[model samples]
Target: MNVAVSIDARTALLFSPCRLAGLDLRSRIVMAPMTRCMAEDGVPGPATASYYARRAAADVGLIMSEGIGVDHPAALGEGTFGERNMPVLQGAAAIAGWRAVTDAVHAAGGLIFAQLWHQGPLRRPGSGPQPRAVSCRPDGRWGPLDGSTSAPPDYLEAVRPPTVAMTDNDIADVIAAFGRSAAHAQTAGFDGIALHGAHGYLIDSFLWPETNSRVDAWGRTLAARTRFAVAVIEAVRAAAPALPVAFRYSQWKLQDYDARLVDTPDMLAALLAPLVDAGVDLFDVSTRVFHRPAFAGSPLSLAGWTRRLTGVPAIAVGGVGLSRELKDSLMAVVPAEDNVARAVVAIERGEFDLLGVGRALLADPDWARKLRQGAPLPAFSPAAFATLI
Candidate 1:
């Protein structure tokens, strides 16, 4: 049962060199951010450094560290959901810890970026000293703590009403926190910064109209909704003008899976204009499946549309190296091979400038090296997370 699959380096665009915000990537394969839940109360440590360095040594072109919480009380709620004491990016000690990680990644001959984050209403209101939910609904509650055996919600309350709207000050605080975190990231010696604006998180909350119902300045128009992101970008750019800043965005939200940010290309362009104007160096467009067409009558995927619309470098993610959807893969119902063929095809077609490999990379840090060297991809099991560490 021994077979050798030799991947040609030329055909493997995943390994081809590319430029991002003036920084040269040794290859086009990027190690997407995955929460390890291993930080000490939102503080990273030596092990975190080694965890990232391992992937860099294995040939990851770029390392986007797991979302690091910014220096705000709201940011602390993110780690309460059973993540390892994930490190917060504040104060001298935390900054030094991150600097160690940056040094390790660079020493391994890899470029690393810190993914700045703030959870906003995602935090359970009762969980921390000032636990406040994003939407402030009376029925809103935090999920069960890690490893607790809580019964599932009854069908009636399962579909609880929409979240309470956030005030203007709440939004502004989050934006400022993002900028502060980006500055800390630069201080930590990161090669660049990636804003965690995707996945129905706080930034995405403002971007999507459904979650944001405020009639105020931050909620009236697409440009206004984009204000929070623009402000964060301006602050970060001011902090590190030479550093490349990437924004990760998604049309889908955790609250509503079927959410769509724009129904038309014109709307999409309008929404993105402020970000482009703000000097965002790149865009990381996330989708559940990259192969699916983004809009009706368009052959291009969401990432394709983003690049074409903004004319900025874009990274496409979602089921890149796996065959099945992430949920199915996590459930162990199907092998991961189902998605790889399509991803390879997308790479061949230039649907995106970079490929972001997620769980597969977590399953095997050397996934890129193995794929390019034609080695067998390791079996992807949920247990791989435990095994890797």
Candidate 2:
């Protein structure tokens, strides 16, 4: 529970019901998938359910559960912070655990989607099985996009080795695992599922040319690069025809913030059209900042162009609350109210379907209600983040 919102002019806009890829949501606020890494043995525990239920009760329209691991061996193969708390929904126990989380969210009148994840070459060295990648590139293959070289390497870049390319059977198995998980998600009562194809993760590495050096059909060209994703997306659709499938993608990768999957809008169209045809109903387009023009000279953000090109609903996320870029979000900061209002205006302008709030909600589970009530926001701090899991 959160303090009641008076439903003034600002909050009213975000609370309106909207349809996304045939799945109707109660509001426009989506809980961006924040990795809590609390699952024990890849299974979501009670605290995981409680963590999500708290936000759902506070009026987040939809919750994209933390990157749930697929059955694939290299899926975030090793867990975060030398721990495997990130839920791995590959077993009966994992399925049952997620069922509890879904049950609680539904009880609180919220919609939830499970974000299927795989880390590819970004997997840590000590994380047990070697991570499978589209190519054998090491982490930070493209390095920092900014000219600055002072920033320290994050976990993904520390002690990570080049990943081995997955074989024909390996690729097929990974795709099948996604389908199986999507089927499990539907059985667990989730409204839909999203493929974690951003942040230079497994799916992302496959899309970005620098990381994927394969000569086979899985790579070479943009369409060839998207083959793996299309296979996974199609599998998910076949597993759950009625379940909405949201494809989360980005032009930039964690490996290189300046990374581009395509050079021109024509290229962007070519890349997205086929994925849409493959069965992506909606898109969660990730950017470091929501307001920045995705391409030079255009007012549209990545999500904006995605909507323009695909005509399918898309969600926009980035410093919506804390005003931090995807990389800078790691630091403690304060949430500014003006930026929040600006994001709402973008939504009102129809740039994207929904807005995902990240660090703000992580700072305060009651962020939405507080914003609605014109209450001062608490500063996001290391202490607050420690309590997130």
Candidate 3:
């Protein structure tokens, strides 16, 4: 495809300035958070700061940092692909390290948000900073393994065992941990907070029925299941009143790729209403393909449905620039032309507010600037993931 023609076809609005949650952005393109698992002992260093600063100096509007474990003992652990080096937002060293990252991004004239995460039952036992800490399960059960997945056999066998359910105390502790992490993020100079309420993590496990099969108030009904997320949102909002909070939710999980959080548009609206009311400034809807319809009856994508339902700005992610979905082979050489055209069309139609580029940005930090300049885009290769380019 001709680069000039592609540029002409894309609307200028996509590359134009915009504002989200009171922050001014250079464009609508966002650098989606992709976990690199390179932090040593859960502490980010100079390399981490430089990696984000490079993207900021380019034309990327907003960058979502790699998932940072909340201030809970069991917040992170070895998962698929080994999260042993996962970063955290607690402790003096971790906070100081993140401060450098924020300072670098700011110096480069870019905005960033910290993605707070907790692994929950997906956390491998006898691992993480606190190996003795028991994995927190929603109802003492890992998610059903009898589903389509890309996970390996050994991982499945290890997490197959039943574990202890989260007591009321456990729930309170995790919520407080999120609050504490938010405070730490604020202190470290983060501009905003992004909660990883997706992909079968701790908070997502509570919202998913397959994992959260409790008869108590925490998981009795769809609306009731939102209590955990609501509390976390309220806590983050209180901890950092000036910063915006973005919640990411997905229909699929790493444990089960075909997972569905809601079957209908109305159900999705119901599931997200409380979180919006609880004080979410934006919704980062995760999907395998950004242009795919979210429901059976509507042509709207998941992010589109979210925006229409909750009246909140939604970020659409997943294969924005690459041709293959993230679950596909990382070794394969992925092209960057086709899907980006679709993303431009999606934005022109008002399907989503922000376009999240993951592997493409990982491959090239100047992706946004190149797109804006109508320069050639580099194809993504597995080599890009080996280091913070």
Candidate 4:
């Protein structure tokens, strides 16, 4: 197979600048948030900044940082995911650490968004006082990497922890923590903030029915399910009115790949109404395959449906330039050029606004720049994760 280095008519438009609400991006290529577990003591170190800066320097339109925990009690730490180190958005050291990251990305001529996250039901055992969740559901023995991913090994999920149900006060504290995190991101110089509402995290845990069977106001009905997500969006919006708020959501879950937030498109529209109303400027739709049709009849992807339904920008992600999202825990990634062609066709037809490249970006930092200059791309190897390359 012969692949050229020159930009194609199909992808040329993708290189053009686009604006999402108040956020301005140089191109339509968004580097999907991938956790590297490099932070220690809740502070992102120099190596973390350099890893992100490499992609910025190579011309990724926008970069969504790895999920950073808020200052909430149920957030990442002590009782959850003690297997790997995650950066935090609280405390002076954490703030200064992320400030360095934002500065590095900007210095490289790229814009970045801080993803505010809370662990929710996925907290590991013995890491904190007591494991708490939307309901008393246990996370079983294993979990997936994120809420959206179908691939497994549960990234750093705790081993079979009994989770206690969250009280009203507990919920309020988590929401307040998210707001404080957003304010911190603004102070750190991020162009925008992304709420990690997808995956099997706290916000997603509340939205889905399987994890949230509460009969209280926070659950039981569709509107009630979204109350937490809406609150998070509203809180972040209030904390940083000028910052573009992007929400990353998915219909699937690590616990159940076949799960659906709203089985039909209409249900999806209704589910998103309150969040959009609350002030989400963009929707980053996460799917396992970018080009797969989201619903039964239409050829539109999840991101495609989002833009049409909400009248806002949508980011399409998942196998953007790869044959598979990931081969396996060991093999990791494989190259499939057809995925790129499929993305180009979708973009040409207005299926989605921003194109998010995940494992491909992790495997190769020059991916966007090379595609722009018509240069050949290299094969991806799992070994890339072992270094800042």
Candidate 5:
């Protein structure tokens, strides 16, 4: 806040109240979901409640909780590393645990969404709490391991062999698992549901052609590729009819940062049409940079194209209050206020409905409040990944 005079007044726009698909938010600033991998035995404890409540109390609007595994056996696993202590959305203990989290956030005057997740092909077979579960790949491929990837050598070698492609039965079971989890999230008192359909996960695997080479109804062209995600969305809607549903998707994958799902605006529009028809209330378009142009012809960002094409409210994220992308090291320090200024301009131009802030919030629980008060913000550090602080 101690940076530019140009955006002094417009910065207040981020702190203003806005309604997203009828879910009223206290402000336009959303706490983007970040994986913490701290829930023991797939259960969140009181510490989880405290972590979220602190941010809610400081006026961060609409907290999207860390990805909670669905009830599927292949839901949670060691992806890119030893992904231990991840939470799930089933059983009385897990539901009760999440209830406390929702209550705490609500008590602090914040609306929260449960990001239902399934690791898909990213799940290292013979790993996770359920070691016996099979890794569900779309075409029995883990994608090209030679691309620009952040996965380690050992992990790459382990998942190199093609696993069994998802049979019709396997597809049905995973879709059912997402529905069951949505019902549980509603029971736990969450305001809405957010689907982790991005970053080379289950739903995204079907979206990306490189991973999903199937000739069946579940894959092929962009329209056909949407079948899996559409089915998942329909199931969630059926289970929790009243809850708003948001879908998060990205062109880049954990397998390859340079991977892309769509190359042109028309292709992007084609990819998103079925999702809107299937009842997606919001689109969380994940990009490495929020303002970067999604395609060659237009200057519109991915989130911008999503809202324009689908007529659905979209959340724009990535490097919002930081100097670099998610995979880059945060060792170098730079004032993040410049990015916040850019966010104001984008929002004013109606680029996106909500601004998703990740690392900045992790670095400071009072990040939203500090912005509201025009106070200096703490620079993001690598150490922030060490703990739940």
Candidate 6:
């Protein structure tokens, strides 16, 4: 089907209703979780709730909150350079803050999920407690550790490097933290929870060999590396059995940028086996561009491979609504209007289950409503990020 014809017909598969863990989503057009750095001390406030509620009111089926930190010291950090409002989900106050956001979304007739995250090595060194890098090498150290007082240290120096490796006890503690966070999310009125295992964070750190080079039980083979994520999933399931847990995985790392977990199909299956057994209700396969083939000579994209491998519903993200790739448009002062026509066509083709609208939604909270009504979409300006707060 042509873009214009699809847009005209308004028969997008994305608008189709679906059920996840007994929660009925109004449609498949999920508002992808985008970090706006607007949280106050890791606690989302009134502005955050209003920003998300607007989208829900406009018809977003599922709203995944930006990566929220569990109650862990390492997961909490100061704001980055140029980020005046970087938020962290740290203590009891932070948990209560999120409760407000969840309550608001629910009150607005929307289903929302919190994206649990641990910045891992991404925490700028020296800015907070010693940051942990996937690799022990200096280059891999969180950001940089230079003691310069002038000119904010490079991304590396801002974060503290993890001096001590996680022991079995530490691992267990982190798992319990995730469980506690999940339970807190339930109490806060969140409909579901999504584990942020993608983008070279804590969970992905354990999955990659370069970062997780230990010879311990959690570091031998691919199956072994999957141990940490499995623990987390099991813990979350145990804590909130009624809440659907979605696992988000990606091939790329913020450190390496071009990293890949599985170059072959067998390897891919090996990496995913344990996670599947751990009770993940959904798989969110992240890619810079969703249409690209996952492996050579394979018609399947990353999302397709994930669904085929796990037999679970998968959410495909990356450049979904944009006319061009988001990675390329990041520094652009203004982003182009979303091509809902193209997005609808992809949705109809069953490339994946959900369409995650990112910057487009950020620019216009009512983007989905506009599409549903076949109204003209507004241009996406990066300046909207600043004004949204």
- Indicate the residue-level lDDT of 317 in model 3: 92
Listed per model in order, the count of residue pairs whose N, CA or C atoms clash below 3 Å is 19, 5, 0, 11, 0, 18
lDDT of each: 0.71, 0.75, 0.88, 0.77, 0.88, 0.72
Candidate 2 residue-wise lDDT at 365:
85
Model 3 worst lDDT window (10 residues): 1-10
Q: Where does candidate 5 stray beyond 4 Å?
A: 1-7, 330-337
Once model 1 is optimally superposed onto the true structure by TM-score, how far is the C-alpha of residue 33 displaced, in angstroms? Answer: 1.0
Listing every candidate in turn, what is its Cα RMSD in Å to the true structure after a full C-alpha superposition? 4.6, 3.6, 1.6, 3.6, 1.7, 4.7
Candidate order, TM-score descending: 3, 5, 4, 2, 1, 6
lDDT of 1 by residue, 296-377 (tens): 9988888888888988988888877666655566547334453455555676776678878788788777777887777877
List model 3 lDDT by residue over 1-389, tens digit each: 12222677465777788887788998888899889888998899999999999999998889999999999999988867664699998889999999999999999999999999999988888888999999998899877887788777777787778999999999999999999999999999999999999999889999999999999999989998998999999999998888999999999998898999999988999999999999999999998888789998778899999988998999999887666787674557777655567777777777778988888899888888888877777777877877887
lDDT of 6 at 287: 84
> Lowest summed-lDDT stretch of 10 residues in model 6?
135-144
TM-scores for all candidates: the values are 0.87, 0.89, 0.97, 0.90, 0.96, 0.87
Clashing pairs in 5: none
- List candidate 3 segments past 4 Å from native: 1-5
Number of the candidate with higher lDDT, 2 or 3: 3
The parts of candidate 4 lying over 4 Å away from their true place are 1-7, 77-83, 128-161, 327-333
lDDT tens string, model 2, 140-210? Answer: 34334453222346664663444456777777888898988899898888889888988777787778787
Q: Give a tens-digit lDDT track for model 5, residues 1-389.
A: 23422348788888888877988889888899888888999999999999999999998989999999899888888767666888998999999999999999999999999999999888878888899988889999879865687677787777667899999999999999999999999999999999999999999999999999999998878899999999999999999998999999999988888999999988988999999999999989899899999998789999999988888999999987767777764344444645788778888888888989898898789988888887767677777776886
Give the winner by TM-score: 2 or 3: 3
